[model samples]
Target: MSRELSTRANNVERLPSIPDNDTNLIFGEASVRYSKGRLLGFVTDEYIRAVRSQRKSIDGFFKALRELNSNDAKSLLYMKNSLDDNSHKNIAFDNDDYKNLLIEYLKDHPDPLQEYNDLIYYKIKNNLPEKYLDWFKKDLRCSLFLAFLVKKSIENDVYKGRDELLEEVVDYLRYDIEIFNSDYSQNLPHYRWDIMKSGERKTADILYIKSYYLKNRLDCDKNISWVKPTDNEQINWMYNYLDDKDRKYIILKGMFFPQTINEKYELILASLDVLSNVESPDIGTKDKKGFSLRNYTLYSMKKAWDGRKQYEANNFLNENSSVKVTKENQPKLKKLMKFSGFTANKVINHSIEQLYDELIVDKKND
Candidate 1:
C-alpha cells in the first residue's frame, strides 16, 4: 500500500507544467496572449505620438511584421512574459489609431468575405468601433447572412435606425433572384414574390405584384377570361349583390363580369386594391377603421387564386383541351403546372390558342 501511494505521488510529480512561452501555449491561452499583447504594444501607449512622429517608419514596421513568416512571428510574439495595467491604459488610448491602421490595411487589401468574418469576430470580442457592427451587417457575402443579420437586428431593436441598410439588403436579394432565376425553377417567383407579398415593403411589394400580375396577364390572356356583364340570370344576381354590398366601388372596371372570368379577376383585383389601400396606414386608422378587413380579404383571395391555379394546372393533363405555357412568358405558370404533374408540352399549344381567342373576343368588345 505504501508503494502504491508512492507510485501515485511520483506520477503526479511527473505531470507536465504549462509552458510560460506563448509559442508553446495551447490555443485558448495563445488567443488571450495574442489579444493582450496586441492591446499592449499596438493598442495603447505614447505610441500615438511615436506613430505620428515616425508614421512612415511605423507603417513600414507593420507591413514587415504583417509579411513575416509563421516561425518568426511565433518567436517574436512569445518573447513578452507579462503586461502591466499601464500598458492596458495606453492601449485604450491608442485603440482608435490601431483600428484606423487596421482598417486602412484591410481596405488596401480588399477581401470582402474574410474581412466581413473578421469584423464580426472583432466586434463580438472587443466591443470597440461601433461602426464595425454596421459595416459587418452591410457586407454582401450571402443572402443567408444578410437575413441572419436582419433577424438579429430586429431582435435587438436595431432595425429602426438601419432602414437604409435593410433596403440595400432587400435590393441585393432582388438582384440575386434576377441573376439566378433558373436555379429557383421549382418556386421561381415564390421566393422573392412571397417576400414582397408580406407587405413589409409597401412600395416595393406593390410594384412587384403589379409587375408580376401584368406579366402573367400578357402571357395567357385566354386564361384571363374577363367576365362580360351579359343578360345571364346568375350574372345579374352576382352583379346586384356585389353592387348593393358597396364593394362594387372597390372593384376595377370590367372585373365583375361572368362567373368563370369574374371569379379569378375579381379575386386578384380585389386583393391588389385592398392591399394597396390599407398597407402601412396609421395604427389607429388600421385598427379603428378595420383596415384588417382588407388584409384578410387580400390574404384569402391570394390563397384561393393560388390554390385554384395549382389545381387547374395539375389536372390539366387529364383535361381534353387544356393549354400549357412556357417559362419565358409565364415562368411561374410553368412551375405551377409542373408541380401539378402536368406534361410540359401538353398545354402549350392549346393554352396559346385559347389565349388568342380570348384576345380576339376582348378586342371585339373593346
Candidate 2:
C-alpha cells in the first residue's frame, strides 16, 4: 500500500489491476484485492473539489434530497444539465438547482470511498463493457476517462467524451510531484529511529519540530514521543547520557507523541539509550487481548508508515528465516513469557526481531 500511495502520481493513465492478472503492480506491491479497494477510495482533486463545492454540507445536501425526492434517473438528468449549464465554472457546476444538485450540496460531502461505491453501482446498472468497467469493478484505476464518459453519456446520450476527458482529467487529478521524485522519503525504507540514527551519538527524549513539508505527502505530522522511564533515577540517567554526548539524541522506540496519529510535525532525533542499571520489564507482556504489547507497538509503528512502506517493514522482518520460530511458537511461548513476569509496557520497546531473539533464548533455557 505504501508503494501504491508513494507511486500513485505516475500511474494516472494506468489501471490499478489487470482483468486477467487479478492483481497488478500498477498499484504497487500488494494483494490485488487490497490495491483495488484503495484505488476506488482515491479521487482526483477535481472530482472531490467539484463534489464538495456543489454542497456546503452532507446534512444540507440530504435535506435537499429529501425535498426533491427525485429518482436516480431524474437526478442524473439534472446533474447533466447543470454540468452543461455551468461550463464556465472550474468545477462544471454552479449550484443553481438544488433538486438536481442535492447530492453534491450536502453539508458533509461524500467521501471518495462512498463516491466509488456509487460509481460501481452506476457501471453495473448500465452494463458497461468489461474493459472499460473492470477498473471500477475489479481494478483500482476508477478511470477518469471512463468517469467523464459516464457523465457525458448522461448529458448528451452518447459516449464520445473519452478522448476529451482523458486530456482534461490529468489536470484535475491529484498527483504529487514528490511521488515521482527518487529522493522522496516514502520511496526508501521506513524511518526506524535506532537504525536511522545508529551512527549519531546522542539520544533525545524531547525532539525539535523543523518543518511541515511532509504534511501534504504524509497527510499529517510525523513527530512521536519516547517511552517514559518508570523511575526518576532512570530518567536522570537518560538525561546524563544525552548531556555526555555531542551527537544529536534520538527518542525511545516504544512510545510516540500524544498526537502522532492526529498531527503532522517533522521530528528531529536519531536514537536513545537509557541507563543500564535501570530495571525495565522484558518485552513479552500481553494485553487483555493476549497479544504482546510489543506486537501492538509494532502495529502502531506500521500505522505511521504509508501502507506500502509497512509492507516493506513486514517483508524485512519476514526475510529473517531464523526468526521463523516467532510465527511458529506462539501460545506456549506466551504462557512462558507471562510466567516470566514480562509487562505489556516493556514489550512495546523491542523490535520484532529482538522479541523473537528473546523468545528463542527463553525457549532454550527451558
Output the number of the TM-score-best candidate: 1
TM-score of candidate 2 against the unseen true structure: 0.18
Each candidate structure's TM-score, on Cα atoms with residue i matched to residue i, is: 0.20, 0.18
Write the residue-wise lDDT of candidate 2 on 94-203 in tens digits.
33443345445322232522343343343233321222222223211122212322232223322222333332323222111112122223212122122222221111
- Residue pairs with backbone overlap in model 1: 43-91, 44-90, 44-91, 45-90, 222-355, 227-258, 323-347, 323-351, 324-347, 324-348
Candidate 2 segments whose C-alpha is farther than 4 A from its true place: 1-181, 184-229, 243-245, 251-366
CA lDDT of every candidate: 0.34, 0.29
lDDT of 1 by residue, 1-366 (tens): 011111111122233333233221112222332333432122222322333333212332233234334322322222111111122222211324444444454335323223323333432232222221233334322222233323322233222223333444453332232322222223222211232344323233333433443343211234223333332432343344344554542232331222343343333333233222233334223345333344444344345556655666566544434443333756665564455444445445556678988998778988
